[model samples]
Target: MSENYYELLKVSPRATVAEIVTAYHAARNAFSPDSIAVYSLFSAEDAQTELKKLEEAYFTLSNIDRRREYDRRLQQGTVPSAPASAPATAPSAPLAPVVRLVPTPAAPAAAPSPQPLPSTQPFPAPAFFPQPPYSVTPTAFPAAPSTPPMPPEGVTGAWMAQARERQGMTIEDVAQLTKIPARTIAAIETENLSTLPARVYLQGFLRNLARQYHMDATATIQTYLARIDSLKKGAA
Candidate 1:
């Protein structure tokens, strides 16, 4: 949590370098090959700029002397000094406080009332009310349990292996064709869909996988959607 490095990484001053690295990697990995519009927003030049900043921050913090100085300043709770050539402005004078006054009023005389004599009858104690005994029974309200999700038909690791072998396609080949990572494709084939990113990205990945396998992409997406719905229902 160094201010100089945090500023370089465009993160909060209290953020750790690990957090900075995580944010950087998240930005880098978010660029999907099939997303022309998203990729277009960050050109090679833009990427280089961000990479340069990240590298600079890492380099500075990784150095012993620089990091020691930064730590010293952080411990001292001081804002690091600027260059000697920086301009200085004159301090403004403090303003005087305004005063207000109000006219004084005369005090009023006290009024007195006659005290009442004590009564002979004793004060009555508060009466307690008693009720007849009644039976109190507890009621139970149980929630219905959620059902387990069903596995997809004709979709398994063995099935994927057979399909890939039949088509003469390797994991790498599928990745290159679809622009999805091999590990992600492996996760999909293994039906560990939660290992993937958000639902929208998963949908796109599934669509790409279907397209690469020459399967009906629409039907494939529908199947994935149904599986997700079932999973949610079961979890509920």
Candidate 2:
């Protein structure tokens, strides 16, 4: 009987060029000198013969024109004549055994098969995990604010800073919300009066800042303005 290239490569007849290539590589590696497989079943000379068959199968099937012609010959059940220069070999040469490939429309033939160690040694047991101490119990602390509450003296720059921290609003965040420059907001937070904008602009900025903190805007504006005035007079 003529050789079946698909059977030799262990790839499906419908396999794509890539799958055929993968099967060819797998069959090659599976029979190499370093491979643990095939040593007992086949001699080195037999292995060489099998490799020749494998190369022949792969080359014939890999070519578009040759594959088409081979398929036509295959379907017609005719053995195509070998090249005139090619020396004839016995048709009864021993074939290499390989892992039978599952057909396509499923996982491809390139999937790795796991092989266990040749030795019979047992695996070590996993170590035990330490138990948590039962004497200590987890405790919950009251949710106190990280920053202290505003001073009783009223709307100092420190108070605005504390409120902003409590509100999780950075100076950049306040500037974004109020359309104020971030440096101005920093100046307001640090009580840097020389850098403070005109009172009209600062008043609008304070009202916007107060709205962000969800506080009474008018009270915040009046108290903060009064505090800054008192500080300025004290400085002079």
Candidate 3:
């Protein structure tokens, strides 16, 4: 039977070319960034082999003729054939088995002895190692872990706080840098949403703060978005 390429790529057989490319990129990203020699989740050698498989799958699935031929061969329980230009070779001959027969040396016979048959009594019970004394006491299992509470809807404050700390800048220093008031910076860090300007301006302010702090601006935005979403869902 043909190998299941869909399963190898972790995608449905009916997946579009774009979906296959997306899956491949996602797999590539999942690997450790420090290890650049390899691709996907394998050794460099194995990754090369895997990449070949991926390419083959993409190629076969992307072309209707190739896909149909592959499917036809798979259904017929036959491997897909090469082109007419391919050479035909003789069938392989069976290999001969290696055998070594050694004659046993005769032993010197001395005496014949009579032996008594064992009794069919039950076998003695095996002795087990002494174990520590213990008693079963039922105890309630711990409660399932709870998900962390999402950050507040206006987390631009937290972003501002983290950014300033990373930059080794105090609120006064940030005030000098941005010419904004120290109180505004303090309000941003403390997440006093009411003290900040319009909601639209909040994103820009947080983005600038993130750049100054060398923090991930995208992640900061996502956190704020998640918080806002939770609040909208009444989950905040």
Name the top lDDT candidate.
Answer: 2
TM-score (C-alpha, index-matched) for candidate 2: 0.36
CA-lDDT, candidates in order: 0.48, 0.62, 0.48
Cα-based RMSD of the predictions, in order?
Answer: 27.8, 31.7, 23.6
lDDT of 3 by residue, 1-236 (tens): 11344555688766654455456555555443445645454666555545555555545543445556545544443432221111233224422331222532532242133222222322222121122121111111122123222235445556556545543457776666556677767766775545755657666766666544445666666676455445446733
**Model 2 per-residue lDDT tens digits across residues 1-236:** 22367877888888766566668778988777667797887777667666766767766665555577667655554533322112344334333332435755643555454322223222231121122111100111122222234355667677788777654456775565557898988888888999999899999888877655546677777888888999899999
Clashes of each: 0, 0, 1
Over 4 Å off, model 2: 1-151
State in Å the error of residue 229, model 1. Answer: 2.9
How well does candidate 3 score on lDDT at residue 209?
A: 62
